[model samples]
Target: MDDRHSRQSWLEAGLSQLAARGADGLSIVAVARELGVTKGSFYWHFRDLKDYRGALLQQWEAQYTQLAIERMEADGGSALDKLRRMLSLPAAGAERLGLALRSWALSDKEVARTLKRVDARRTAYLAGLYTQLGLDAARARTLAQFTYHALNGRFLLGDMVPAAAQLDLLLTLLTAPNDEAVAETAV
Candidate 1:
């Protein structure tokens, strides 16, 4: 009787479990039970709980960050269009998983470091997009920081997300004729 699931299945189930119940749901036995399999099945898929967790972190970064950036870059659109699409991605179900990771980061140093690095990578990408729209490097980076912070804050604050038109206006300010004009208008 082959009760063993594939490694990908194991990793995916772990992510779902984490998203559903935070890091407490990450135990090997818990995930095995959720999958209707025995704890031995987890051992077959990963070396141990630590190995499983490392795999999960890698999978999360790849699926949520790297692949997302790749898909956005592949699209034929202006920087503003890509920014709009990027902001809208949480609607596609990455939010809960991402929030779960953020929650987990609060308690785990390793996760905190990974989250920071991932965020910097994302912010740098945003800065590049803003720069493409003709903003100076310093201004572009500042806008990226605000955009990144607002996006994450919205993820946490739920009902506080700005409407589509507001987001469009914000993106438009990045391309305004004067640096001080964009800065003053934002405030």
Candidate 2:
């Protein structure tokens, strides 16, 4: 813990706090205490709590969604390979942060809107990858939705199901042929 904190450091602390305690736990005082600094340090980095929150949302969006899309696109593999890589990408703390934001969205319209936008961007990226794998538009969209839903569901279910087993089912669903995917979704 440094005496002085960078803006990024504050944002990271905010994210961790959000994950651990949800929106109500995110405060300048809390972040400052976590960083072993005074609240003045937070004010130095952000104009106010609103500004800090906006920056936190932007950081989450960039790190969780935009950077992920960049990594998948730059993977330089077959579309299927890229898709698998995207699916298996290990984002530590992402599930916690996602759950926190989703809970926050229930009480904040802005957070809900931001969450919706992020979900759309992620879903579109997955659909694009599926389209590259030669699935038609309709089927690609269906698989994309299913993939996103399964991922979220896994997070929601947490330890109720084994991670390995859930991942296996996800892989089976994602890598299946377009016809099979459509049929499975229909059931």
Candidate 3:
């Protein structure tokens, strides 16, 4: 591999390691050994552990964030359908990227901060979508929070909730407007 590919390979390898073993077991020496390269190779791509972590965050944002937003914004469906897909993302991935990221955030301050920011962006984007759907600000905010927590909870539940049933519940609740109060219609 060339320089760029080599660097990405190590970063990806690092994330995979973190996923399987958590950050406590991640070490430059270990990643170097896995790649069959010297520790020096890790330096060529990353300045230090922090740099590698930053790269991992960047990789995550690049690889997953937009795809998720796009999935949530898919055409011709009730917002509930979009919401259900967002909730089901973690279970759908064999690698459990969502769980991995959540695990990383538990031990890494920077990762935690970035996760919060990414979540805020997602929530805001979803709130805007809700607003466009005719929800009031408070209702939109509540829906956004509900959707965010629902998805996170869904990831944690995994096998406990049958995938199909969990998705069905989310679609039913999230797609429908908050309450059937007078003077307001569900989007």
Best by TM-score: 1
Runs of candidate 2 with Cα error greater than 4 angstroms are: 1-4, 159-187
TM-score of candidate 1 relative to the true fold: 0.86
Q: How far off is model 2, as Cα RMSD? A: 3.4
TM-score of each: 0.86, 0.85, 0.75
Q: Give me the overall lDDT of model 1.
A: 0.82
Count of clashes, each model: 0, 0, 0
Report the lDDT tens digits of candidate 3 across residue range 1-187: 5553398889878877777667777788888877778888888778998888788888877666666677556654765556545555555542466677778788778889988888887788777767767788887888887877766676667623447975675555554555653224324
Each model's lDDT comes to 0.82, 0.81, 0.70
lDDT of 2 at 185: 56
Q: Which ten residues in a row have the lowest lDDT in candidate 3?
A: 178-187
Cα lDDT, model 2, residue 183: 74
lDDT of 2 by residue, 37-132 (tens): 889888778999889999999999998899877876776788777766665655466788999999999998889999999999988988998888
